[model samples]
Target: MRNNTGPYFIGNNTCMFSCWAPEKQKVTLRIVSPKERDIPMEKDDMGYFHVNVADIPPGAEYYFMLEGEKELLPDPASNFQPHGVHGASAVVNHHTFPWEDAAWKSIPLEDIVLYELHIGTFTEEGTFDAVIPRLDDLISTGINAIEIMPVAQFSGERNWGYDGVFLYAPHVTYGGPEGLKRLVNACHQKGIAVYLDVVYNHVGPEGNVLHRYAPYFTSRYKIPWGDAMNMDDRWADGVRDYISNNPLYWFEYYHIDGLRVDAIHTLYDSSAVSIWELINQKVKSLRETLGRPLYLIAESDLNSPRVTQQPIIGGMGFDAQWLDDFHHALYTLADSRGKRRYEDYGSMHQLAKAYTDGFVLSGEFVKFRKRRFGRSSAGVGGNHFVAFTQNHDQVGNRVKGERLSLLVDFERLKLVAGALFTAPYIPLLFMGEEYAEEAPFLFFCDHQNPELINATREGRKKEFADFRDEGEPADPFDRNTFLQCKLNWLARRQGRHAIMLRWYSELISLRKEHPALRSYNKDNIQAEVIEPGMLVIHRKSKDKNKVMVFLNFAEHDTTYRVPAGNVLWKKLIDSRDARWNTENIASAFLPSEITETNFVTVPAICIAIYTGAQ
Candidate 1:
């Protein structure tokens, strides 16, 4: 293991050093400079040694001492380490950074169009400050919130940042805690709300030292990784406080707008009272103190109402949940392919159910589970759910890790994109999907253990036994896998990819312009299956604004009749043309461009949007 060696500064010239060295009978702080000096430390009750150095300053280098062994180790809870992950901890003066977003306001989650991106894969440079330049791109796309993947501190130089051990510390490999602060400040200045995805279910399998000094993990319930977080077990109050304080720290110290709770289904708690309520209380308290509307989003498979229901209704106070059923239905229906999770979906009925009830599998027999599963959320508001046609897990967990572009034709991709933007729910897009970038989003980690690495490879093989022959599996720990996932900035300006990017930008613009297209009320939304390969979604607003969306998934044209109504219709937007040109699709129609009985032929795998004339 690498040790930190520094004349480092921590809280002025005098600094404190503490680390858990249970394996060593004796430990010494070896100052390997000028004249080698051995400094002894007093072991605390938690098997950690602590001593304060009187001569160290802000940029000094240092390391730890262990049982006659000399190794430099960084502070286990380092706020900043400019040298390396294994180098001396540097003191970060947080008050020094000049902030210009003092009047920065937060956009409520109810009115947000979120865009989820992994900072490492979002740009070629893959750093916090590097992502600052792309704020204009997101703002132009009409995205109100940016949900970054986990930034928690993890071991090694590169990772997804989920296996973080230091709950309060940002990853040292990615410019540490201060870098994240700068990013958040910059985002606030650009009027973009920053929401970070956090992993509280389980820590990663690396330099996780929390188990040594605190009861952070429990053996009572088994999670995907090692041990489950001790949410409700013995000595858990402190643990819960630690976990809850983490988000508060982010919101208070870092000025983050909200947090996306990762995979809440695995957050097992055998307590009689709801543990979700406890978290909600903590969030409420923090929001009161911060004087801002803080938000929480849960990614759960269970169709339990408690996840999104209001606290006054004896439910958890999460603002929204990730609606995966919508994606699965859209995936199964649009591509006409999917065997695993999509096995129970793809019917126009299921798609209709998803649009009306929020979840298609609500208490229905699902072929994939071989059991009746989920509950219908019929009366819920669409704004209480986040829907996407494709996401990080759907695209990255595949054997080949190819996005929708690899499985289906390009037309189908555009059709799904149209559905995503114009749907009743809040829409989100995965990175690079707007321009149709071909690079795959594969699982890439920087694990040091060889056995763990081999097990990861084998586990992936077993998980995709039925789908393995599609393509070769890329090693998740390989540096090349991470490199390949980076977005090709030039792809947005070349050929068909550029056309796809423009189409996305235009659809988003239209959605923002038309209130009828973006209403979140389920009652205001209606859809009908015209045929096996065609469906139409109609949205009606109180302002007498109404729009109809036609989606054709077959490889041949399908003619759709306008509903029998008392008003004329006018074309609004169509995804058939190379650039969504409304000039022809809007100006000409079979029935003089304004008739209740006009029939229009929707091209193969195309989408058309039309509005009722005022």
Candidate 2:
């Protein structure tokens, strides 16, 4: 059946309304504005109700009345919601917006330095237009792409966007569809690609009317958020099409360069062709048809290289997958408390493994899961893995959503950033991470349901029972919590923040300028543990250019002897330099030739980089 879901303008002062509600005996298109009337829709053979209403101009308000019921429900495929989620849907003319990014093209996957930001908390104003003026700052900071958290219409004005219900509409509070298009166009003009984070594993509890309209959810598998999406069950084609078309809609209409699929680990599908494969195939087809680059990045904890492998090779064809093991291993090494998933990490060897190999748990027995987890990602290219020391989940999901700046010392923080940029995988930085902003990224939501709000509060306390002694977690329902997560722009020009920002800029510059540092081939990289808290990494390019990174995690000064080799090396970056507020413990330039007897003194928590001919 041809799926013509949502409102489409058929000209002549008329709009054709169609909805996929197979179970409903009778569906009525109730127009609430420009002459209110209940127009009965005719059901086709495919169980879809559609009707063409005359003189129903653009921006008209309407709803779906199922089974002749008096209670009106929002459209299952609403294109715009002027009011909040509970209110009536608005008719949006998608063709009216003037876009200016005709010459824009997406950045290559290997060249991407992703900066993930939430639209609601990225700036003081917390709106799409507010983010426009800050694009220059991000571009200057060396980020080539910006990944926005979801903006799908949710319950209230304030949310992290994970609780979105109306998949097609941008949140009205965040400037809606027009606001998003403007942001994307502005980003394209500045050579920065925009990636949107989308959640499809489960529908949010509040404002979700999908279950009432169709067989959109399944009860076979239980997810942390709610019931699983019915991707392979009875009458599942419409649901699958609805979910898959969302990415296409964003790419085609919003001109989104890529999509970061959230929590694919929880997306349960038992079918001949998995939902992921179907989505990937559709994305590939779209990219081919458009003759432009469109990427699909998945957030999966499976630690399997096949997640990004091509379907032709018997794997799901994702462009890249988040390498969370790298973050866990690095976080554990930085702070040895072994909190949450950190329990599976914390060893220096694991950090070294993450540097040499993409995944630390490659077919290894996991003590936490009590089972063998992950297959070997041996043949996977480093560019296929997106690595980050801190992201929204790592920071916001915490008891207080404390950033890395609050958890570690300044020196250690610089060292972490240095390690991340020098690694062989694509790097992602959380918003305000470059400047070391002090504001936290707390998990806040504005739910109108009092019962859901109370349940959320109790649920948060129960989840953090292990860390209760750390202090009480901020209430997710509190408006103050949302306000506290906003970025402090003034802090960027202040003392320590300014220095950190400079350090990040310099690191990014180095990464971009050096061929060896830009190489993402894991086989060309080597890592070794010098001691308990000291490590060395060497990256080599195809052109015989090489770069060596030395890290000292110890609390005291230590002399690191050069490995057994005779080579001419030049010092590039020293975290302990006076420019970064650290004591100058090492010389700016090292000896041109280093023998077995050559040794360099490195301060505590310092990172040093040197370049040499391979």
Candidate 3:
């Protein structure tokens, strides 16, 4: 386990470098900068070659040369790659940062209002420091936690971060380790939790050199991004160690409150002890040692409760999983251009099912899967699921990468936001979603390999083969594709955008302040379809406080009977309220909360929230 974890140990201007190269007979440490030298590394019984070199200060660039190989390779566990992925790795001491978040107490997963943002497009400067001045804005929007996209070093400055080759190193372009540490410290100081997205299932094709040093990949299984990591293959102990240690590294060194583990279904670990089990145990132990909560949220495609279920019940003990089903059902039902996943969606019934039950396709026929998929998520607690109207994938994997705001009208946008906030689960807001930012989040990268670039273009073409009616997708290799995705923060103060932001802020306040709206207690929720394209959601707190959410997905106004017949209901929030949407000041919308209400008319694609204890 010694060499399976951190290989670089620096103290007193001396660094001990270790490389796992069992395939080579000799390994040499080659210092390229701050004076050049080549020192032979001694091999241990466990296939690890290590050497303790004096006068090798932190920030010095070095590389490893294998025996009989002419090319020098960067360390697989490099902490910083300042000169891109192919350049020599720089030594970084993590203790140099002055962290001021010792008294920072992170909230539980249920209370986390996660706002996911890519660091590059979040600000004009696109550095860690640039995101600091905007923290006050996020706080005002009621975002308590920010789940940053992967920041590990990738091939170039522009990437989704899933293509990162150096898992241990923070991207040099984003201010490197020091910049990330400062961001985390600042977030904790403002009582905000920082969650980092990490990719462990596969590595990027460009700038990837882990296979050169050790058995970091396996030929047994193929994943779309890159080779499947060698989780259960021969010599997989080191690979498991690598995957498990990454979370601890982020939590301990970077002061990250949680990790949004990306695409866990792609991991092929058939061993008795899977990588999930290994990482769960380690994080739990670390949680005890740190005396604070550490969230291990997974982004799994499988609707299996095993992701968040406890170990005793044959589950992975993760904190929660993203509920893509909720997004799929709601998107297809409301948006004009839905039905991408093909879970047999596009119905008000399915949206109601996603509200009452966690997954809409529980053992139901899926047109894409061509079989009955998923088990019932009936008794699962809402806190174990994270709900959203749109995420990075749902928006970016489109022909034009158009956001929901652009595809739907203003009322429908408010309806979608209402659906997400009222649900009994953790809510996540994609960056720019609060103000309905129409800028698309396109899939982009800056790989230097020509062959890889061609492959990427071809792959994107194949992905949207069925959706060619929308015109050809943006050229991902084009620099304009990356630049077009940057968020226009100034737009938040403008016309419709300002109104949407106010509506979202009101919904978030209602979700946090109202006891009936507390998340994760699914037993208090009851959703049913009242009419065609009309559904009513009834929620009650233990204190008898009640909230009724009326949604009309039809194109025209529709009438629906109230949850409690002939009873008085108080109007709490209306998407058409003069306070939020100024256009509805003198609108002719039906009064949903009458003193003796039986049924009331709701505008098309509108949402009205009523509260009262009958």
Candidate 4:
């Protein structure tokens, strides 16, 4: 508790600064006070150095002085660096930041309608403070949780936040620690839970100095970025503890409600129960200790139910897992979309399967993998899965980074959104998706190394070889590409963008107001594949509240026979109200409401929500 990791009493200060520089000949404390003075450090038996100084306190600027040179070096384990990733570390006083959400409890994963946004691209300013003004938009739109892309310290000022090297530090360019505290506090004030994305698979390629200090990464297995963290080997306890503690730190320190673990499939673990089990165990313990809801959501392609099930039930006990099946299903259904991964989908059957059950590929043949894959979710709870139509991965990883709006018509896009929101699964919307932001979400990283940059470019080029005739694939390392990826706030105020924004707000309202709509029971869901181009989802509630969702994918009017159960039906929402109305929309619905009994007709490419008493 007394910062036992370091040892140091430096010049003119009582604060003891320390760093684990076991490989260095001589280590000094670089304090950015009167000047960048290099204070000599004393070594300990455990290969750590320390220097206690009287002048240093919270907000003091400093970095690990390697070899007595006062170079602008990043701290190997800095918690907050206000300058930059490669600059001096700033001391953050966690106690000093005011948190206003005392009565706040995290919304259950079952009730979470998540909006995943990259902070740098979410707003024009692209900083923590900049996101505060935009909270009303998300809160009003009905998002209960905002899943922020990674905030860890990476090399440059701007990044996707995935290529982070310093695990403990938040990015300086994004307003550092206090700024994040402010943003989280702002989010809590608006009743929106914050879920931070973390990368534990591998450290980013640049400014990674952890290997020089401790045995953080091992040679046992390699990941895309580098050697995976040794989670089941010697000194693995410390590594696990570091990651485990950081989640609670974000919760207890910054008041974040949850964490989205990035890419658990790449985490090489040889332990019997696996590394996921260990982390989920810790998550449960910490959540119990804090007397608040703490969620662990994993981004895994393994399709294993154990990733989200409770440990007591012979499972890992993670709160939720990202359901790629939902994304793929919607992606295929919305646009008849991509040729690359769309080979496995593009039918009403897959979308309907995803609506009723959680996954369509449960022990089924996956043409993408060219094999039978994915286990059945026999014991898995439907609430333990986060489903989405589009995420950063789907759009950003693509060659041109085109959203569904770029590929589909407005009617189909609305239908896709309605299906996702009304489905019996947790829903996530990518940033700018609420308003149908036309900007591309490109894969952009700021790498200092030329070889790394070239490799990234080459990787993108190779990935898009099938699309070579489509046009040139956008370079991933281009600065302009990243800048173009930023969200244009002006979109929300103009044209059909405002209408889409309202539609999202209305959908969120529907999801929150209707308990039947939020039910995660897989078997309780029923869908009628009325035709090849139209599907109707009947969400059955135990409370006797039945809601039927009609989706017409084709560009022509289709007639649907209302079930012969002697039920009186009411139209909840019709997408054609604004566009199809001859005079006023209100007058048009009144006549149809009185006459349309058991026979209802659906307009082309529109989704309508209907509730009835049977």
In candidate 3, what residue range of length 10 has the lowest lDDT sum? 1-10
> Residue 530 of candidate 3: its Cα lDDT?
66
Task: Tell me the spans in candidate 4 whose CA falls farther than 4 Å from its real position.
Answer: 1-55, 65-73, 272-274, 312-314, 579-597
Whole-model lDDT, model 2: 0.86
Local distance difference test scores for all models: 0.74, 0.86, 0.86, 0.76
Error of 1 at 170 (Å): 2.1
Off by over 4 Å in 1: 1-91, 272-275, 581-594
Q: Write the per-residue lDDT of candidate 2 for residues 1-614, one digit (tens) a residue.
A: 12466777665667888988887889998899977999999998777888988887778999999995678899978888998888898887667689888888789989989999999999888899999999999988899899999999989889999999988889998999899999999999999999999998877779888988889988887888767899888888788888887888899889999999998888887777888778888887888877899999999988888898887776778889999998998887776564554778887788888888889998878988899999888678888999998999999888889999998988889999999999988999999999898899998999989999999999999989889887888999889999999999888888889889999999999999898899988899888787768888888898888888887888777677777556667888888777887443442433444445478766778898988853
TM-score of each: 0.87, 0.96, 0.96, 0.90
TM-score of predicted model 1?
A: 0.87
Model 3 lDDT tens row, 1-614: 13355555567888888787776789999999899999999988777788888887889999999888899899888889999899999988877789998898798787889999999988988899999999999999899999999999999789888888899999999999999999999999998999999999887788888888788888899887657899988888878877898899889889899999998999988888778888989988888988888998899988898888877677888889999989988988887657655547889888888888899888877788899889888789888898999889888988898999899888889999999999888999999999999999999999888998898998999999988888898988798999999999999999989999988998999988888888467778888886778888988888878888888888778887654455568888877666566464745465745654476888877788888755
lDDT tens digits by residue: candidate 4, 1-614: 23434222233435666676555778867778545577888887656677667656666787675774545566666777665566667665566567788888877777778999998888878899999998887777788789999999898877888888877677888888888999999888888889999988888877776765568788888877668887887666556655655666677778889899999888777767666676677667777877898888889988877687666666666778898887787777667545356788778887787777676788888888989988877446578888888899988877789887787876677888898888877889999998888999988888888988898888888888888766777776777988898888888877778888888788888877776786777777787787768898878677877777888887677787776666666777877776422232432221134122456767787888877676
Clashes in predicted model 1: 19
Q: What is the Cα-based lDDT of residue 348 in candidate 1? A: 75
Of the two candidates 1 and 2, the one with more favorable TM-score, higher being better, is 2
Clash number for candidate 3: 0
lDDT, model 4, position 376: 76
Candidate 2, residue 62: how far the Cα is off, in Å? 0.8
Q: Which stretches of candidate 2 lie over 4 Å from their true place?
A: 1-3, 10-13, 338-341, 564-566, 582-597
Model 2, position 287, has a per-residue lDDT of 89
